[model samples]
Target: MEYFLGVDGGATSTALALCDREGRVLGIGHGGPSNHILAPGGEERARSAVLTALNGALAGAGLESPAFEAAHFGMTGISRDSEPARAFAAVVAPLLTARIVRIESDASVALAGALACRPGVVVIAGTGSVSLGRDPLGREARAGGWGYLFGDEGSGFALGLGGVRAALHAHDGTGPSTVLETEIPRRFGRSLGEIPLLFYEGRVQRPEIAALASAVTAAAAAADPVAVSLVNTGAEGLAAIAAAVVRRLTWPDGTAAVAPVGGVFRAGSVILAPLKAAIAARAPGAVLVPPRFEPAVGALLLAMQAAGVAHSPERLALLAATWELRSRT
Candidate 1:
């Protein structure tokens, strides 16, 4: 019984899955941030995380030893260019014992997962944002994903930044007052007066600021105008990214399926109404579809493909069913 491994390494977390030749998922594991760009000592940290997850999965399956015939990793920050791919290969080769290992950017896996290797678009709005699509002819296109510095519109960072601006504006009586003024301070365990000291004293990570996005969402749900506008703006920005992908792919006009993923979408989908409206206004027939499979599953599919394995509907169903059963346990 040959086994294959799939790893999805994200900026904030990582997931690994073990599957058999027939596509039955034997075990699954998870770990913390594996994106090298964000985490120092990235290569080693990633290696340790992957190994830990693989071992956990094996233990869950009651297997003392297991050999992976092939493995694939979809990770953020791994370049698509050949030169960078080669560099990454060197960094990762010493870490795993698999017979074959393939690595690609997380966007590729997200796209494949959402569409099942078929042609469609995927918009991911998490701590960051990116829009990706693949044409039926295997052509791929992308927009955004420049990180929080330049782009990442509609992402957690974007929401957090907007929330901060709103809070500050309210403090100065320059903008519409909202509940964020109170909520932001509460999150940091201090009054608004201490926020500057907390930030300048190196007591907080910038990403933690984005953690307030959930509170903003809650406030919006409670009818806070400022929060409502912030969420609406985020939805609009995400929709614009999706629209760009649609235009690049030139998908047919008749409810073209678009899969939305990432934490931002999960937390703020109510805001997506305007995004849907915006897309429809421009593309006329685009429909948003929730992802049927996670990005790790897509990595598994790619691993299977790399190993010359054909994925039938029956096989995929078996894998999904097994995973669902395991999840319940």
Candidate 2:
């Protein structure tokens, strides 16, 4: 039986899936944070995460180490053919014997998963944010994936940082009074003054700060004007990212799917309503859609493609069913 492997390595965790040519998923495994760029230990950290997940998946599949027909690793902070990507690829390459191996940005797999590789845009908002799209003609474009240091506009980190700043501003009388002043301390168990020290001292990291986005959205839900304004601003920023990609790609039918993937979207209509409106205004041709499959399955689809395999409807249905069943446990 010809086997395939697909991995989705993100800022928070890594997930790997093993499947066969017939689209039957044998097993799924998971590991910790592996975003090589942001996560300490860099390529070594990422390599450990991938191997841990791969081993778990293989064990679940009841198989010893075996060569795969094709494998794809969709990783955060990785770009096609980039130096970091190449370095990480080299670290893992020796462990797997595959006819084809691909290392690409997590956004690439998210887009493929969101649209089932059909052609559309995907905006991923986690600790970071980026937008990527592919035209029907196979032309591709991307915008806004500069990472935390540059701009992660609509990302969880941005919203969370806004909350922290709002708290600081309120405390110092520089901004309007908002619940975030109390809310921030309640969440972090620290006064506003200590928040900056959390980062400066390395006691907290990007993901920790990004976690505060939920508090901001919760405040928005409670009708805090300041929080509401931040939400809207963040939504507009994300829409702008999507708008940039939409402009670069031509959809002959004058329409395209723009899927928003990640934790920030969990705010539901609180964030989605503004995001949808902003996207509609910026690119009338774009339609916001939920992803058809998660990124690991997207990576699997890409793996199959790299092996020169056609993904028929029957195969997709099989993959969907099996993945759903496996994920339930």
Over the stretch 125-187, how does candidate 2's per-residue lDDT look in tens digits?
878899999999999999998878688998999999999999899999999999999998899
lDDT of 2 at 152: 92
Cα-based TM-score, every candidate? 0.90, 0.95
- CA lDDT, every prediction? 0.78, 0.90
**How high a TM-score does candidate 2 get?**
0.95
Give stretches of model 1 more than 4 Å off: 37-40, 81-84, 193-202, 252-255
Model 1 lDDT per residue over 1-329, tens place: 88888887777778888889898888888877667643468666776676677777787777766667888888877756555456556665765567778888888888777777778888887778898888766777788899987888888878877887898899999999999999988886878766656767988655576677787777878889999899888888888888788777755444567888877766645666766777777666678877767788888888888989888998789878987876566
Which whole-number lDDT from 0 to 100 does residue 309 have in model 1? 89
RMSD of 1: 2.4
> Residue 162 error for model 2, in Å?
0.7
Model 1 residue 218 CA deviation in Å: 1.8
Evaluated at residue 224, the lDDT of candidate 2 is: 100
